[model samples]
Target chain A: MHMIQSVGIIGCGALGRNLFHNLKPLEGLTVECFCRSIEKDDSLYQSSVRKIEELFHCDLILIAVSDQDIIEVGQILNAYSGIVAHCSGATPLHNFNGKGGVFYPLQSFSRSVIRSFKEIPLFIEGDNEETTIQLYSFAQRLSNQVEQLSSEKRQKLHLAAVVSQNFSNHLIALTQAYLEKEGISFQALIPLLEEGLGNALYQNAREIQSGPARRKDTKTLDAHLSLLKEEKRLLPLYEQLSESIKTYYEEDF
Target chain B: MHMIQSVGIIGCGALGRNLFHNLKPLEGLTVECFCRSIEKDDSLYQSSVRKIEELFHCDLILIAVSDQDIIEVGQILNAYSGIVAHCSGATPLHNFNGKGGVFYPLQSFSRSVIRSFKEIPLFIEGDNEETTIQLYSFAQRLSNQVEQLSSEKRQKLHLAAVVSQNFSNHLIALTQAYLEKEGISFQALIPLLEEGLGNALYQNAREIQSGPARRKDTKTLDAHLSLLKEEKRLLPLYEQLSESIKTYYEEDF
Candidate 1:
């Protein structure tokens, strides 16, 4: 917790790599990244890659691996005396060993996309006040937004996040699949999708909801189900999703 | 089928009002709007209000009422000599009797908000070629994007639209409800939602999906389900949506 003079990042995935580059430029801090299987030599952060043992000497060790790998990586740092934090929104703060903390960057990151961490919200939590302040100051150096959130609230945030981001993406993917199955151009829905998104952003989504499900129009529902009957994969999805919507808004009518 | 010099609009809902005001200023087009129960006097389109008997005099009659009323309105317009068109995406073109057609403006409409139809896709269909051409020209005068779509294809579009627009809106509303219930700020998820939407727009949504469901991370899924167990409404939604996503990507693994 002493000024975080040295920082170590595990995993070379999107979040880990971005964190490495973003933190490396800060003055008076030695940065290192540990990758189990490093990529080709042509990568940008190749020079910063280090073995796991070298990271044990750092002031803070941050794990940015997959959900399945988080526990293993945390176990590997059992001997390390430094604060061990994770970059996952879903994973608990207890996954690590001594001085456990969370440095969750709550945003969508991709290997192909270069993201600026300045605008990303960094939710930090530490096992103790000292470690919390350490992570807070550490996060301040990289991002404009930093907040100390409890693990319970952070987990709930993660759940809401799945509903907000992943579920919407899957719905869109399903729509695209439906359009492709019908031999229709996906471009036709783009404008409507944009408008719908704009409306949801500016207005409360529940009040703005419109469809056969929202109206409980049995006739249209039956007709749509009849059309989707041929699509074995999509028919159940349509039924379940519509049923869910109908149930959600049943009290209004 | 002749020149649509006189345009009569039925219903005074969001779409009807907007269409009335939009078409009123056009040259050589006498626009009249007929509302079953007109609003208070001082409303913008109050002067354009007329009875169903008066609508029978126009060259084109557009019924823009709710789905359940479409049939009754169409029946009432059977004696009208002009082209009777229903402005709906789900309703088939056969609802009307004489010169049946559709002038479905495929976009979100609201009574409180003013919308421009220039970018909205106007899908037009008619009983015959001459009527289609007449409707096409009339649509061209209102908005830029216009196309001739079949009743069958238009019905399919309406279904896909419910999936793409309404389903996503409901998902967001669910997320908002979850955040509010957990005493978390909804603003925290905005950037993430925007990023996810951007990724979906630029990349294939099926490929960009990242979550416990997409990764099939059972541990995280279990943790989330445990947290959601208290909410009876969201629990089943989480189960069904995740199950659908898992089943959809089962072939990938």
Candidate 2:
């Protein structure tokens, strides 16, 4: 059996809370944290008097803080010889100066809902071979789909995620804004929304692309544009994105 | 017990295929289609005939085609007076001239893969009171979640869907293209992709938004943009989307 005894988590924000909560239930692992606000509980094994010194004892120190604070935390944790990892999608392991690694759970986590880590893919990146093996083994315990990824690869993945999740969510929000402006209930689009997401799973997105823009049906595009003429902000977005889509499917039409 | 004898599918594409296959095994419903291609199996009761007169015989005609094609199909089917409907997201039932309704399944359909319609929501719409009732009854048999939507409302919903699914998919494609150019496999982003989609189900996306753009962390954003500096096409997308995200979180930040 693989032994992963003590884990220290820095920053008890959303990601930290999730990790701590989830990791607490696992056997043969004890979790500690160095939070600005410390709570009295037996579950939390240790609290750091000084953040840098906290890394000396634990087998793994997870820095679940903001990107801006990662380097600072890394510099502080550099003194210790333990496996220091951060849970960020974009930041590279090299930011830790060969002392730490990345233990990125490629999921959007929240405090209210419990996410299933079993099938969730964990992207691991390490500075050295020993740390890589250790991190991969740790990830394997939590998920079946764990892999070693380079910083460049991880960065690319992060950019893709921004498109898939963040930007996509913004689109939904924009749609909601448009509907609300038109006195339409957001609930009306639920079915169509579901279908759109569902369709992409089975078909290549390039093949399934549709709309006035894809067809280059100038008439329909003009009509849609005309309908949104009153909304100045949305008009430019509609026009730009439509042009992009038209350019994408220019050969098809 | 509800009696369903035969289902008439207008478009023999992905959505049509799904409906045809799912309704095939139902107790009393036999599926038939009026497709443009004769390549589809005749044994499955699919016909290549385009004329509406030939298809007017069925008890339920489900139009599963493009928005632009809906009016043309609806105009022809309006003469037959059978329970006419289309499986379009944004098109209105009034387009069917009270002779038809909508059997809009709120799930994405791909002909290559079989999916369960049980969990998928179905949005029903009609021109008249009786047709709406009938459409609702029909939708209830296949799906657990069914809603009555108006044409105007459905149109708004469709617009929102464009934002959520279509635009989001485009972002994914763009990200894939960008990464592939850098010799990165787009497959690496699947975990993040799945997580992003899965997260939307439980939480409001606005609350969970993360990224250098969302954070207004110029250092990281600049670093990301610097990497994409050579790619002329992606730079604008990266900048515009980053601006949009920043604009969205302006109040909170």
Candidate 3:
């Protein structure tokens, strides 16, 4: 059994709170926390400290603060002898001086939506081998899909994640907004959405892409464009996407 | 028992082939097909008619052709003394003069990928109430989820489907392309992709959107923008989407 006696967490935000809940329940792991605002409910996991210096005694310290606060949090814990890690996908691990690593959990977390960490991909990176091993084991405890990635690769992965999740959600939102304006049911698009994502699991999305744009159906494309003529912002988006799809298939054929 | 005695499918494309496989197995339904090219393999799914006029004799003739071909197919079967339906989401039901409706299955189909029609949403629209009930019962034999939609609403649904499936797939392909150029593993983004899409099934994507733009982190946004300096096409898309996300949150906050 690998030993991880005490883990310190900074910042009690959604990610931090989730980490606390998941870690506190694991056997042989004592979780200590420090946050700016100590709530009464936070005491259920463990008593959180008021100062950052108090958490320096732990075997591992996890900085679960915002991206802006990461550098400041690292500076605050500069003298800490314990291993340090920040849970961020975009932020560079080199922002910290020593013994720093990344512990990014790739999921959109909400307070209301409780997600099991068992399947969540945990991307970890460390400055050195020993720290990497420890970080890997730490992540392995929470997730089956634990990957060790470099800072540069992790940054690229973060960009992809942003596109795959945030951008896709915005597109779906735009779709819903457009449909609602015309008194159409959003339910009509759910099956298509599910089927599209389901196809991605079995094949490359490029191969399974189906639409007027993919087929280069100029008539249907013109019709769709005409409908979006009133919306200046959306018109360009539709045109660009349709043009790109057309260009992609044009290149292929 | 719901009697869909004889069903005729026009066009033996991926969608038509899939429909044939799913509908042919049903005990109460007999599926006949018509394709532009009558291939040897297609003989397994009943004898496909070489001409469209041959299908007009069936109880229900389904024009499962391309969007561009729907009008042409409709004209070919103008004097058909039976219910005629085109399996298209975008093409207006008005394209056909008489005895025509819609029997659209909301999915992306490929010859290699076999999907069950039981869970697939079949959108049915008819020229009249009697035709609507007949179409509904016909759809019920294959799928549990059958919905009646008007031409106007179905048009909007088609627009939404374009955005949800086609647009999302394009964004994912772009992400993969970007990551591949940097020697980053596409595998890193899979978990995030799966989680994001899975969340869409349970929650509205707008509520769970997360990224630098959603957080309005200008620093990280600039970093990502700078990284895409060489890729002029992707840079504009990235900037526009990020700006949209920022503006969306700015309104809320």
Order the candidates by DockQ, highest first: 1, 3, 2
Lowest lDDT block of 10, candidate 2 chain B: B40-49
DockQ of 2: 0.39
User: Which pairs clash in the backbone of model 2?
Assistant: A195-B107, A195-B108, B84-B100
Q: For model 1, how does the per-residue alpha-carbon lDDT over A1-253 read when each residue is reduced to its tens digit?
A: 2699999889888888788778888999988888778757636455555569888889998898997888888888888998999888988787365599999988978777768789889999998889999999989998999999998999999999998788888888887877777777667677888878766866788988989999999999999999988887668768887888888876562
lDDT of 1 by residue, B1-253 (tens): 3578998888889998878878888899998888877656636555565568777889999898998898888888868888988988888887366588999998878887767788888999999888899999999998898999998988998898887788888888888888888798877777888878766865689988889998899998999999998888678878888988888987662
Candidate 2 chain A: minimum summed lDDT over ten consecutive residues — where?
Answer: A42-51
- Writing each residue's lDDT as its tens digit, candidate 3 over B131-218 gives 8899998899889889998876777677778877898888887777777788876775676678777676457767777788988888
Ranking by TM-score: 1, 3, 2
For candidate 2, give the lDDT of residue B48.
Answer: 40
Model 3: residue A22 alpha-carbon error in angstroms: 2.6
How good is model 3 by TM-score?
Answer: 0.91
lDDT of 2 at B3: 45
Question: What is the Å distance of residue B151 in model 3 from its true position?
Answer: 1.5
Pick by TM-score: which candidate is best?
1
lDDT values, one for every candidate: 0.84, 0.72, 0.79
Q: Provide TM-scores for the models.
A: 0.94, 0.79, 0.91
